[model samples]
Target: MPQQVQGVIARSKGAPVELVTVNVPDAGPGEAVVRILACGVCHTDLHYREGGIGDDYPYLLGHEAAGIVEQVGDDVRDLAPGDYVILNWRAVCGTCRACRRGRPWYCFNTFNATQKMTLEDGTELSPALGIGAFMDKTLVAAGQCTKVDERARPAAAGLLGCGVMAGLGAAINTGNVGRGDSVAVIGCGGVGSAAIAGARLAGASKIIAVDVDERKLAVARELGATDAINAREGDPVAQIQALTGGFGADVVIDAVGRPETWLQAFYGRDLAGTVVLVGVPTPEMTLELPLLDVFGRGGSLKSSWYGDCLPDRDFPMLIDLYLQGRLPLDAFVTEEIGIGDIEAAFDKMHAGDVLRSVVILDGPDSDSGSTNPLEAHEGEQVSA
Candidate 1:
């Protein structure tokens, strides 16, 4: 049966999101209904509110989410109701050229639900990243739901759906950071910090974190960065080179996505070193660089889309790692709030005051950002 659930929606460009009843249709072919447990408040959602992603008005926001399958429509396979799942925006079509070539990560024909989730009046809504998970329930393609360990904390596990996954994939997949590699990540936000953690997990001997904020730097160290550079105080490239014994890092990640940061990352790597760009740039952003520098660099420059991650392959493995305490996924979640706190979470994210503000709809979540991993980074509160 079609049902109504409370959800957050941005009705117009630059308007505050409204908590209203949303119409979620019964799962159609190849789709499933997810009862959301936790969803992370991310900058991309803020971009939707600010009309940055598209002119798609009345956007259904929230994508970094964990939930349980409540219903599965026809043609769904290998997934059943009551599965603990993390929702991914990309649900690759198996017959796409990319998928047929065994590189589904570059799937050009990713998909979403065929039916629209709408307003009470039947106004169709465009979902952010093809996922509208800020509600009690959301409908998604069955392929979008990656089942993970049920024992995982929903607040912590949900982070894997987007930013965290991107960061880790930047290092592990795109960067190919390996044992004894000296890596430097520019930007110490959620994504960058996850890169640092990924570098460490990949056995990077020296992981340097570069950022303007001191608090973020502190958290970076806790997440396995061996050195921290205050980008505001000195040339980050120079600092990264200095820490890498004047040779430059083996891998440099531009998590900030700006021309300046990209340039710094280019120069911050050693000869033939890899440069992975995980940051997303605005459409108006442009870069003018020397052609000789590109030719002389003699290395790979890669852009990671969703960290080149295939959710099914990565999500469950990551959750297992988290459960084993090998990954500090909990560190990324600064606090847990209800659906009403989405707007404020955006404010805190913009201010660089928090790594993540998770919206917990059910199950236990942190009342305070007091996890063992967040001890050093915990100080100010984003809200009362």
Candidate 2:
């Protein structure tokens, strides 16, 4: 039988999301149904609600989530019921060309649940990034479920499902940040701070964090930034150059994803240093730089997608590190919120007030009212 559950849904573009009853199908071939424990409110979710992603209406929002597998499809082999897992958007198809070439991170074909979770009226809904986790439960491709240590806090561990993983991967995987290297991360948002943490985890001797907001810079400092530069106070490029002994940093990551920040990253590194662009930009955004600079730079300029992460390989390791106190994943969770607080959380995000406002699915002490209706007629009549 299809499960009726409460979920956050963006019924139309530029409208506020509502907690509605959704009909989630049982796991089909190669899929799994997960009982979401916690879901992080990310900027991307706001983007989807604002129609920044596409015309896909009735979007089931929220992606960064950690949960337990409740059921698995017949063809799913590696996962089973009761497994603690992080939901990942990219479930690399092993037979894809990228995987065949040993670059599973670049896998061209990713997987999502074949069936749609629908509005009670039987209207099909698009799951955000194929995870759609802002709910009591969600269904996803089996490969999207990466098992991690159960001891880790769900709020903290779930973050590795997206932004945190992207930042860490941008520094460690794409930028190839190494021990004793001088690293500069431009943008002190959740992603930027994670980059700084990644640099620290990778043993970078000098970690410089740049941002327009002083408060964010403070967070960056706590995350292992050796120096913080408020862009509003001075020229960040010049400051980074000065801090790196006039040679600039060994690696500079642009976490702001704008042309100005990209240029800052380009010039904020040594001649042969690497520049990694991990920030997301809108489709309408275009970047222009002097042709001479592109050729003049002797090193690489790269863009990181989902931090170039392979969930199966990186998630467990990160969870282990988090458990051992080697990585401060818990620091990223600035607050815990209820499902209905998503809009307010977005406000805090836009105001630069919090790193992450995680939705604790079932609060430790209380039983929030279930959004699901017991009867099919009740389910179908509730508008999303």
Candidate 3:
């Protein structure tokens, strides 16, 4: 039987998201039905809503999520019901060329549930980034679920599903940040701040945060930034160089993903430094840099795909680190919101006031609430 659940959906480009009855089907072969506990509001979701990602209308728009597996396909053996896991976009297919080369992180072919989740009118909805999770329950390929420590709170644990993972992976995995390395992260949004935290975790001696918003820069400091560069005050490139003893950072990450920011990241690093682009850009946007400068830079220019993370390896390890207090995962959860409050959360995100406005799917108190628990929960703050 198809399960009817309330979900957030963007029915048309630039239109406000609507809460609709989503008909999630039972797990087919290689798929799993998840009872989502929490999911974070991400910019990617907004992009999807605005038709930036594609013309795929009625996008079910949430991805960074954590949940308990309620059912599994007959062919799925690794996961079982009652298992707590984080949902990831990259469900790498082992047979893909990238995976065959032992770089599953670069797997060209990812997995999504074969069967579609539908609206009440029977219109099939396109899942955002292949995981539609901003609801009571969602169906996904079993490979999209990565089991992690149940001890981790859903609000914090679910973040490993997207933006946080991308940022951390940009620094540690893609940038290869190391001990005593000087790192600079441009744009202190959730992703950029996570990169700062990752650089700190990797023992970066000088973690410089560059952003126009002072509030975000403050958050970056709390995360691990040693210095904050207000891009509005002066030239960010010069500022980054000044902060790094006039030579530039060892690794400069562009979390903003715009051509201008990418150029800043390019020139803000040492001659042989690495520049990691983790920010997602629109299709029409183009980047133009000097071919001479590109050749003279003498370093690697890389783009991080989902932080270049292999979910099986990265998810569990990150959750454990979060549990140990080494990584400040909780800091990312600026507020816990109800599913109804998703639209308002998008406003908060645009205002740059909150790092993440996560939808708490589980009831306020796990032991309390009516038979339909999602109805009883209210948005609440998690103290920073």
lDDT tens readout by residue for model 2, 1-384: 899999998988889889999999999999999999999999899989999999889899999999999999998899999999999999999999999999999999998999989988999999999999999999999999999999998988999999999999999999999989999999888899899999999999999999876667767888999999878778989999999999999999999898889999999999989999999987888888888988888899999999999999999999999999999998888778889899998887876777788899955622323221111111111000
Off-target runs (Cα >4 Å) in candidate 3 are 365-384
Give the alpha-carbon lDDT of every model: 0.90, 0.89, 0.90
Q: Give the TM-score of candidate 1.
A: 0.96
| Candidate 3, position 240, lDDT | 94
Against the true structure, what is every candidate's RMSD?
Answer: 2.6, 7.9, 5.3
Q: Write the per-residue lDDT of candidate 3 for residues 211-320, one digit (tens) a residue.
A: 88766776788899999988878999999999888999999999988898999999999999999999887677898888999999799999999999999999999999
Model 2: clashing residue pairs? none
1-384: candidate 1 lDDT, tens digit per residue: 899999999999989989988999999999999999999998889999999998988999999999999999978888999999999988989899999999999999999999999999999999889889999999998999999999998989999999999999999999999999999999988899999999999999999998877777888898999999888788988899889889999999999998989999999999999999998998999999899999997899899999999999999999999999999898888888989989898887887777888999875544854443333454432110
Query: What order do you get sorting by TM-score, best first?
Result: 1, 2, 3
